[model samples]
Target: MLYDLNIAWSPSTSAAELERTLRFSAALGYNVVALNHTITPPVPPQVANPLPKFPPSPAGPASSSSTTPDQTPNKQPKLPTVLHRATLVLNDPSAYHRLPQLGSSYDVVAVRPTTEREFQGACLNLNLTDASLISLDLAQRFPFHFRPKPCMAAVNRGLRFEVCYAQGLSSSVPGDAANDARARAAFIGNVVELVRATRGRGIVISSGARGALALRAPADVVNLLALWGLGSEKGMEGLGVLPRGVVVNEGIKRSGFRGVVDIVGTAEREKGEREDKAVGKGKAAAGEAAKEKQEKGVDNNDKNGNGENKRKIGEEEDGGGGGPEGDDNKPMSKRQAKKMKAAIRKAQNAEAKTT
Candidate 1:
């Protein structure tokens, strides 16, 4: 029902308020929760710039607004940082004891905690005990996908969570231009391949949203996805946003990872050809567009002009290859009429030379 979606995080939001927001979000058809640290911000009047700014402040005291972290006058609050790390029950007995409580309350439950071990290297392996396994092996099960970040590739035959970076595709971070485009391309292909290999079990994209602006817009998400040369149709299907079910139906014909990989390679080839054609056409179109814009002004001067100049030029013209019916009119093409008017207007504006 909801094709458009976004994740919001206020850096100064209170924990209680966050819980309320999450509950409200769940009620409002938001299936995913891009978790971040609670940031309790001060109330501001409408029309004011609401975003945080750079250079933390020489005076240190910036806003009249109350911040939960900023309450302590003596200490400067470090920016709240959240990490997506593995938290093993056996390894950490205390966390295991509290798992059910934490898991039930949040919409997007994770098996990790605020730890640093195994955080950077591999895909997070979610292992449940005999009790948790029982839930996993239940006769009827809601497909639970375990998507890790883009660093960790998706696995076959399970509820998979694909943890993709929310911000890097826009800037000079790892997921954007810095990432080797070819290997990243392969990773995208591999991710799709894993989906087909696992059949229709699970495929969820999870955002590791750390800050307020860390989350990506859906349009941007679509564009970054298109950059990988991944199938927009399949990606849409994977995100469960497929309009016509093209990729969903198409996946059925293919069997296993190899088939999906082959399809991806083919898709990439086709995408390259389309891009080449688009580039060629875009250059030609851009040249024509630039010419038109140069002949016209930068703003809404050309399209919606009163056409009084055109009318005046038309009126003064003899219609027999002579210029406008003025004492000193230059020979001009019809296109130059507007330019001539603007020039005269400019000279008249300068007041250096009188008519």
Candidate 2:
């Protein structure tokens, strides 16, 4: 599914406008969209998500056969899957401690670094912060350049870089053509530098659009990125694969144990238990059959008179039998039988001499 991970949201935003933007985004083929609430420094003591939950769009199959004449011809457009996101603006490195709290509250947690030091920290040291995306306002000029070392380091650590197309599309002040042109130039130059830094590996293209007019189709976004030095394949991945990975990783951080292990589903656990029980039953049945066979063998030996003969042989071998032919009946080694015969002969000679 296509993803637009960043769409600007604020407390002052009206519900109607937000709904219209979302509908337009869905119409442009974005299957999933995140409503991003940007938070600045000095975060509140009690961090809570303020984004309102929108009801599912009423654009499914018609349930009623009877249509009223009063029904409007233009039906409500189907909305995409909406997710809540929070973007923490990092101006100082000390404010990074509250990331875990914000991450727990939002479905996706991102960071916008303003300075060089903060940017490096967000790229390399923010692994434990549960933040998945590093969003930078590329429309402004910075003293530092986007180097491959930090950008690729962030990508290797499972963090994606967000390029918001809306920043280049319009100026902050309305009716200012010069500012718009300058912002566009800066955006294009920064995008080229960023693409070269990471080699277009972990880039995620998003609208970051506050209104519906700034939103573009997925194909158009890809083509736009291609113009700015990112390959078509990589741009497509930025929209679909990379953003999806960020979403999934953020979800795992919330639900998984320290973001490492996940609990198995009930169905899988039950299946394993059933297999173990079946194995145990099979082993028990086999053991019982073996025991019964042994008992049957002993009974057969006794019934056939072989058991009595074996018992007699054992008694004779132990010198416990009173029969005269006990020595002959006993099973013995050849040397042992010869020694017995010689002893008997010596005893007979001694008895005859004494008599």
The number of the candidate with the highest TM-score is 2
The C-alpha stretches of model 1 lying farther than 4 A from their native spots are: 2-94, 112-158, 167-201, 210-212, 241-355
Candidate 2 worst ten-residue window by lDDT:
60-69
- Give the deviation of candidate 2 from the true structure as CA RMSD: 8.0
Pairing residues by index, what is the TM-score of model 1? 0.29
Candidate 2 lDDT over residue span 257-307, tens digit each: 888777857644588898999999999999999999999998997877987
Q: How many clashing residue pairs are found in candidate 1?
A: 18
lDDT of 2: 0.84
- TM-scores of all models? 0.29, 0.73
For residues 93-124, could you state the per-residue lDDT of candidate 1 as single tens digits?
33344433332222122332222232211133
**What is the TM-score of candidate 2?**
0.73
